[model samples]
Target: MTAQHGHTADRATTAPPVTTAAAARDYARSVVRQRWDSASRTAREEDVVDLLLVVSELVTNAIRHGDGLAAFEVALAEDGVRLTVHDNSDAVPDVAYGRGELPSGGHGQGYGWPLIIRLAREVVIEPRPGGGKSISVLVPLHARP
Candidate 1:
């Protein structure tokens, strides 16, 4: 990260391509963890935990539901961490807002949607021109003034 006019600029990172759903989660978590660990300052313990969880959920969803994890980006902003996952599938995800497990028993993977929605301060889903979608989530690191 570089300093811009005295304030620290957001640090962004992209993980290497992962082949499987489990690999996606593992790789994303490691990238996020390593980046922050090497930074000048450390994030709060709770924030770090939340970040890991968010990363796992998003990457897992991308690999499981979409064509695959096309790309993953992590940005450390002034206020929080932003994670974006892109997949090659055009199908939109069903955003579950309320509490309850997925209908497909423990084997199902959709349970992450509700948790992602609840943890993220903001969520945005965008469609690619060719065919695919990207989901972005911002997880706050500090309380707003």
Candidate 2:
């Protein structure tokens, strides 16, 4: 999917569309780096690590479980980093959007959602206009001393 822009002004700093999870992580790291470099208070290294993990989980889920990734965007917000991942499926995992519960089964395949829930805030899942859905979340960045 094409990148969705809320305002034309943001287009200049907006990251290009990424298809793979690795690309998404790289783009997200660059954003964090840019923000840290420019801001007086940089995000803690641990917080940045958490942000990368969340980015990986979101993009990987979209590509693996949500048909395929439609689009991906990472923006530096005042309080934290905002991530939006659009996929070609409308399905939303109940464990993620519902009670924020972890999967009960013993299978080793259900950690991503819980990990995301623990690391991110204001998690939202909404259906896109044409098709598929968009998952958005804010991974708060803590300032380092």
Candidate topping TM-score: 2
Instruction: Please give, for residues 29-124, the per-residue lDDT of candidate 2 as tens digits.
Output: 887676433535677889988999999999999989999998888766666788889899988886786555666778545889889989999998
lDDT per residue, candidate 1, 6-94, as tens digits?
34436667767766545655664565455444435545667766777877887777777887888887776665678888889888765
Q: What residue pairs are clashing in model 2?
A: 1-70
lDDT of each: 0.68, 0.78
Cα lDDT for residue 137, candidate 2: 91
Q: How much is the lDDT of residue 136 in candidate 2?
A: 89
Please state the error at residue 39 of candidate 2 in Å. Answer: 5.0
Regions more than 4 Å wrong, model 2: 1-14, 98-100, 104-109
Candidate 1: residue 22 lDDT (0-100)? 59
Residue 23 alpha-carbon offset, candidate 2, angstroms:
0.9
User: How big is the positional error of residue 66 in model 2, measured in Å on the Cα after superposition?
Assistant: 0.8
